[model samples]
Target: MKYTEEQLASIRHPRGHSVTFAVAGSGKTQMLVGRVAWLLQQGVAAKHIRLLAFNRSARAQLQDRIRVALPMGAEMPRISTFNSLGHRLCELFEREQQLPRHELSTSEALLKKMARRALVDALAAGNEKGPVSAEMLDDFVAFIGLAKADIEPPDVVLRRLPAGNGRAFFCDAFVRFERNRQERRVRFYDDQVRDPVLLMRAEPATAQRVTNKFDVVIVDEFQDVSRVQLELLVILVGTRAQLNVVGDDSQCIYAWRGARPEFMGRRFDTCFPGATRYTLSRTFRFGHQVSLAAAHLIRHNRHRADTLCISAPSTPNTAISLVKAHNTGQQEAVVEAIAAWCRRNGARRQVAVLARLWAQLMALELALLEHAIPYYKPGPALFDLPELAGLLGYCRLAAGTLFAEPRAREVVRAMLTTPTLFLSANALDNLVEQILSAPEQAGRLIADAAPRKAPNWKREPFYLRAELWRAAQHAWTGKGAADALQVYAVQTGLRKALEGDATDATTEKRLAYETLLHLAQASRATVTEFVAHMDRLRASQRDYQAGSDEILLLTTIHQAKGLEWPCVVLTGLEAGAFPGKRAALEEERRLAYVAMTRGRSQLFLVIPPDAHFQANMEGRPPPLHGKPSVAVSPFLYEACLPASIELGAVLHQCRPEDVGAVRLPAAPASNQALLQRYLRAVASSAESSGAT
Candidate 1:
């Protein structure tokens, strides 16, 4: 709870208009709370102080902090999001201005569905060719959302688009979506800000009336605020009100969601030219190496202000590491590293594995579950998805079941429902009984039971599902298990059964299946072993330690932003995977900066060792060259740390006999060159000294 000199200076800023550049792990919330308490002591009324947050979660965090920062029964300050406060402004004069208050449509889940529907309809009507892709739908939705925030009509939005029918297609979708909104008279997220901006601009008296309601405004996470949201604050601060905003420009990774970081780096300073600026660069969360690593990576970005700073050095001496491994071995290596971190610290769980794409996370999830490491995923648990379950069932069914295995029954239940067999459960149960009763001749029993096939099996009187299941069972080991899974997919009408209405969610389901196959190949885990692993996980699902607060967290880098853990691991650090195919290099570099900073004590960057190896990036778009081939990401090189090989080797008492042993690549060898040397030595040493 100790405040640094920089933090204390930022906390006591005399207010007019001010911006605090709180770098990563700089305890932004504490500084903001400290300043608010300072303001209250300076006679600023709590009722007159408006503390705005970027989102509901942040608003709640602020509310919690305020309670702790102030004494019991202290006057509570006004706290809300920018949109909520703006919406209230419009509401204040709704009746006087004859403005109709549209009911806010706040459910993102429902809106995504409706938005997809509108885009599909528009694309179909416009004679657009091709399957309606998730990217196309997302692009259309982003356009509509941005257009509304800019208060631009469909035509204005069209002129701003890149040269393609996408402009027209997106515009068409926007018009259709706006019409739907009008018909329903429901306010979307953008409308909450857009309507108020329009209201205030059209009527200065209304703006003044709203501004008169508050004397001081403090906003957190201002880096992610869009242009319109900034405009609302500018209007409210018009000459009279005091403004104080704290955010990290380096952490501005939400550009895809329409957040404008320019507002944080440049626009805010221009809008309030005389604003008192403070840079709280002393990061209290991490030590020297973490600070230096984040600094090196983030400095490459074109935007972002403030120099990275470290609080104090400590034991476990915070370090950034680069791991070179094969596609399969990478997962295993990460698991071992995490287990070792926990063991060394004598800790339970304060670790996270963050990646840009879900593919990496999915692969790690399997590895973690197999080892029984208690971890919490933020969104949908991939293993719990029906698509995965169905595919798992196919493998389990093909692998066959014995009388003693309870998992076989679960597999049967999943198989029956996932793909309809056009037969009663009793019939399927009898077939399973036959297979179980006659283990050696189960194939013969199935073949005898199957009816003769017509020239066109599709037109056969009997459903071919059972016969297909039998055919899948013929090859049920190793790669053959994965092969059988594909057979089941094709025979079962995978698109019809698993893909629902061609939505993006189904796209994820499809990709998830691909990840499952990847997991199968990497682990070479038998169906029985897979089931047993899952059974152990489920059995301990309610165990106290398993349910304890975030032992191991697996999430995307975007979700990992604004969160910190004692140890953090960033997976898929290969060229295409980390920078990503669609996003800009600078943005991706910023992502790397954000990712590395999340670790308070340790940071590990896991990359596939060779170009031939594909680090699991299934769900995302392929790199332009085709499939992503492994290459050293520039961000990794930016960190300037020695390959962890020497340190690790030293720790295991297996140092390379000489540095000369590292094979220099034909062209400019990197850390991977050193890792190759280390791995070769480790393999040899493990056979003798029993060191891993």
Candidate 2:
């Protein structure tokens, strides 16, 4: 809670303009909040302040902190994510220009669909041409960035054009694409930000209004800001918006999404010539060993430097351990061992197993789940649109019935058998046929399709229709569904359902009602559209689930940003796995840096002895620790400490001294023990039984 000398100095010198380049876990948000609180105490009006974040979740967290830190009824600063702000400004322009709000934000979902079609059409146009390559697809996407919600439209590409003619051809195609978008009533994200800037630039009064309304502007996650985003900020500030920019260039792992950290590093100086720069180099999250490891790993990257202020001598003492598993099974066994160690060491409840890839976490999760571990997985939102809609649909159909209780059952069913959500079209048809033919009765079919519950959830119903809905809705809507319309609907619906009988609401039900309200609000007053919207939502949900390693944390290195766990076991640190044979560019280096930095204290690096070994006759490698050893990640050796430890020899030594040596069966791994504990807790809970 206390700030360092540098942080204190920055706080003491709050002026008209400043830039704070903060690293991840430097309590950037807390500092920002403190700065705001200081200004308010100095009598800055809330109406004249605005806080802009890179994403909604960050904005919400900031807002929550502001409300709690300030006095009751204290004025709240206007907070919004960049996209939201851009969307609003676009609306204002539409009103002023009397034009329909430009449909910008060509969602990647939409563009990918169109791009595939376009690619196919282009291919058909040249039947004699050779087959398309993945590189072609990548180039095509680059020519025109993939569209996302509120993203700018990508420029178009022309096939069969000479290399020299590519630019001109794309420019023309880009213009045509924009014209087509207008004709077709579709908007891309570029239009959302671009139109607003143009409008405000042309209208001094409008720009002045925004600039004047917010006396101080704070932009977090600035390293991810695009040229377009920077322009928007400039308009709001109008050469004097008093700006604060905070982010870590080393953690800019979103270049594929159009982020340019260099722009952030340079633009503040270009925009505000006299702006002072403040750097937060100290990290309070990771232990000294882990931090040093990270610092060493990142220091090798050409884009990163030792002067980034990553060193903090005051950090706790913790060592990074390297574990070599003969195979994934062996790796999982090691994880289980560690989890057990944590529990026995008195921090079972506080430990986490973080992985660079969700696929890499599965073995640990399965081992833990089979063993019944009790732990919470915190990464991002759990239920997605498609999953939420499906759950709600089933809940609606089976409200207060055995079928619809505890919402997740329906999701499990959809995952296994429903074509509308997870199962492939053919697979779904086959499943339906099997079900209809009574190969399995409805009850059995439901059971077969059901997802195995995580041991911890046995006492907690996976499907709390109202609560699930609320969580899903809030995640999507950026707020709780407690507005007038939602409240009225809930009151009226509950009244009808209860037949006017008065009953006390339990905590779960209350949460459920709130979730239901959010879902209802997100449904946009149209059940059909809501259902349709859920497909993408469900797909994304499935993608996220697929990415995770069961109870273990599974996500891409990029996804691991802004998060740190007490214990991190990074699997697949070998050549192909770490750098990823496919990702040889500088971006891959940045991603490696991000992944290496996620550990708080205990760090375990799992390396497979060989890349081509098969653990079983099935010829399939174990799930999480797949085949290993083709190459080691360069960073592993490059970033080694002066007293570097070797895992290869240690693992070999852990094996029996000789094949003939007598040994008792090894105990279950820590992950397995944790899983067992969780399962026992959930299984014994009356709530889980009742829900089921």
Candidate 3:
């Protein structure tokens, strides 16, 4: 954990303002922690320091690091994500101005819905440029978010829009969407920065008060900050507080989300005059092979700083390998390779399978399942689980009915017949049909059809029905969804019913309940708003923790950032798959760089012989008219050539069935041994060339 000279300089740089161009795996977080400690040593009060991270998880990590670095009794600085900070600011502003307190909806789904409604209204008014489908509405909503991030005015956005029939329609829809937000007194996540920046500009005294709230501000992942976010930071610092921004421009992969990497470069200098710049190039995550390959790959980017000064690892091994397979069967080979490595190294928890997209992991997941390999997929949030869907649905129905605005009856029928109730499928279907057939007498019919037997009392479907009805009644009495769920679970032994005997299942059910309770506690709103929030989250498709640590990780490269594995497998290394047909080449290269650098001691890039055919045909062999093969990505060539290696000749080629027989060669036992072997190989190669 010794700090490098560059890292120390970054930590102790002049205090007015500064920017750190920290490369990936360069221990940026460590330096940030060190900077906090250094500031404390220089008589800065921890309570006056503000550290902003990109996400809650990162913020928590920073908080942990800061606490560990400080003396036990030292006060910790305020650390939060930008949105959390905005929420705090909003609260303060509301109290000061006596404005109506409102809730912030960070759900993109809700924003999309609002935008869609506005577009439809515009179309109804005979606007020829209106969006015609839900997909188009989604795109327009995303564009609006990006525009706001860029701090672009509506006229600027209109001018930049492609000359299309929908330009006028979109402009009107955007204005209507803003007006709707004002009427609802709600704020989205982006407005956390947007509104605060607006307020600061409008009220100089308030801005001064805000700036005085902090003595220093440190922002992580500064490369991904949008223009409005930068503006907010500038306003909050306001030539008084020391400002420190840390990020790597080469790692700016969120351009589609309106991240302007240039802000971390020249724009930062312009905003904070006399700001010192520092770069941390020494990486401690990956070994020499990974560092070399990543440096080579990212240097191809058109906009980047100087070449990274990659420090060679003391225990550098032959960590990089190219594995070639024939077709879809290669997934099994990949699984076998993983199993073999796990057996030899006993580090399954430190291994991962990273792909470009989530869909690409389907075959790998199936293979891992077949092999009985423990794996985690980052499932949906607790409320979105299929097992809990019934509970959520029932709560929503009850809440909706209280307002006299229930959803479709079919939805109600589905909720009543959910598999979690353990009702006989045929009987439930019959009951639903009867209910649909006789809507007026549905309640009476349900009571009449309810089973009367109690032989297996707890397991009886009648008992489940009664419990759900009871929960619904409680919900109707104004109990929140979380409370109602807890009541139902306890009253009917629902947890025991769902858990059965499996320990993992029992643990998952318990965690789901705990998660529900936590969500309920965090939301201070009414039952209806809570239910609506849960519904919107379910619709958003965001991944949540699977609550298991002893499992192999399967995730996209994007999700694998800030994480490292001892053994890493990069799948689908073909042109169309890795680079993707629609993505910019530079972005794809950065992705490859990120993937390569994730490995600490081992890196395997798998290239299927028919990659093109598999990608085109969805992991199946080519159809009758499909192309026969795929070319290896140019990145592979770029990395392999300069490393003085003939990848194709040296790579181990095997079929799915032969994977068990293809073993990795034993590496040198010690760093000195490995360095000696490398030197000998170089000398021998030179001798052979001289003889030729």
Candidate 4:
């Protein structure tokens, strides 16, 4: 891993406050690691150097890289996520001040629920000016989160409440939330960062003492740093410690999560006067064709820096395709075509499918699964599975003492009618109806409705029902929700029932159970908190599986960041889909740029042939009754690339003369206009010669 000249310059830049604008796939992490090694070689102690990463995975990678860079017996620098660093600072402050430790709420959803209820109560008392809706509640909560990240005070938030109907309600709720948090000595996850900043501001001596502990501070992914995070860095560095920040502004896509890419621009120089700026523009991940396409697409963004540094061209006329599929059958046909291409090129593990949204990938996922394609979604957590909904519902019911609520009734009904339960449907329905009718006596009714013995080799449903009831009672008394769920799962033999068949369903259920066990081992929450966490997990549609790297990847463009594949399939490249009707045009263009850049050697952009063509459902094709109205994304035209072709003409048994002629958009008269035209001619020649 020899360093490029640009990377070496970034690593060895005069040591003061500096910012590095690292482009996508430009070895940012490698350069950062090199800089840390340089600092160590300059006599900076490992203990005095701190590195911050955006996530645990990134932190782990940094740690590994630093270890490799250091001598065999040398010590490693402190590397951690911002949240972890904040937690460490808070703990040290608490110990020094002799203050009691306060429990932090791990679940943001729990805090949101509390805030929503407070707003509802305030609105009921006529404190609000207009009607309150769920969307309003969600928006108010998000606003508060962002405000805290920006270090805004309650009065400032009240003054800036977006001039909406729930303004008064949001203000009231915000004030009440502050008061309640102070009273209970409870903090939200954001407070891990916020409280430390407050503590440092109120105690300059403490802040100075902490600053003395670090000689250099390096922040990765600085483009996504929120205002408060920047403030924390400033306080910690204290004009003495060397500060090095690295990130790419064009890759900053987390605006919804309080990220402010502007901070990575001129604000860096403002924060640290005379700070040097460096750019790592050379990308080693993709070839010239992919780079040119990405460069042209991102040229539309007004805020980005100059064009990316291009590498020398290789394999002249890179393989790029534009496929048109009309219906579900055609969509499946496209998948089959991809499979054929994979087999011919031996690129099964090097391919990925990137979509604009998760919903759009559902049908593709199903089609791949039906075709026995090995696919992997990196983080499909157990809680996101519909199969585990019943189990989670039962856990919630177990945590609640009363069984009269509608939620409790629904959980019981689902449990009784579960396929693994082997209970008669009519009997379960009658039992549920009785319990619903007599809400107050729901517990007694459930116990009485338990069926007798079933003529099977295994234990009966009656015994399982009794075990579940006992587990619920125990959970209500003292045991946590996680504990109760574990007990119920074991006693009911759910894992055994799900494991008998060696099929995909069995594999999924077993993996889900393993995830549940992992959760149980990690959780320290009480029953109520556990239930709330579970609720939050259910609301979030993240999923995870082991060995994901060995399968085909299907994910959103957002998730596709920081990743690359040899062959990439960009799906749903139509108007109102890729640009997305509600998204900012520049941001959407950046997204398209990101998707295009992920491909190393080959890229395929899939387009619907007609307005009626949709891939929204499983096994359902586009309606067969409409004229062709769907057009390729404006981005394809905007890129001015000429490698596009219809998929129908390029399938496995197709003749070279059947290749659909590509309609190249007129090249824009920008810096790359001439290059685009030259590339178009090359692609035209290649296509006519039957080159993929």
Per-residue lDDT of candidate 1, residues 1-692 (tens digit): 45656667777877678888887766778878888888888898998888889789989998998889898888988898987886776677676663575787778766666677677778789885333444465566777777776654667655644433435767777777777876777887778887878777777776777664678888898888876787788787777778888888787887655565678767887888888878865565665556644665676677667454433322235666656643333367888888888888655468888887665576677666667677777766554555566577656555554334554554444454454333333455676677666655554554454334423442331245556555545555443445555666776676454544333334445555656666555556666665555556556643524475646777888898888888888886766446654456666787787888788777887876643232212123334564334576767656544333233323233233543354422212433443444345333431111000
Query: For residues 69-180, could you state the per-residue lDDT of candidate 2 as single tens digits?
Result: 7889999888988778878876776777734655665478765545444554555554523323333434555555422211233332122222314333333334444555
Q: Is candidate 2 or candidate 4 better by TM-score?
A: 4
Candidate 3's displacement at residue 440, Å, is 25
Candidate 3 lDDT by residue in tens digits, 1-692: 46767788999986679889987777888889889999988888988888989898998888998888789888888888887877787888888873356678878877877887777776677634322443356557766776677667766655643332445667677878888988888888778777767777777777776775788899998988888788888887876788998988877767656675578777887898898889886566655566555655676677666646353233235366666642233366787788878888876788898876654554465445445566766633233343345555556656754223243444544455433433443555677677557644554555555555434653455555654564464545477656766765765566665455322223334434544554565565456777776655533322223434567888878888778888999986765556755456776787787777778767877776654433432323345665545566667755532331221112213222443333323222322232333333222321011000
Q: lDDT for each of the candidates?
A: 0.64, 0.51, 0.64, 0.64
Residue-pair clashes per candidate: 0, 52, 1, 9
Which candidate tops TM-score? 1
Comparison by TM-score, 1 against 2, better one: 1
Ranking by TM-score: 1, 4, 3, 2
Task: Give the better candidate number (2 or 4) by lDDT.
Answer: 4
TM-score computed on alpha carbons, candidate 1: 0.72
Give the TM-score (vs. native) of candidate 4: 0.66
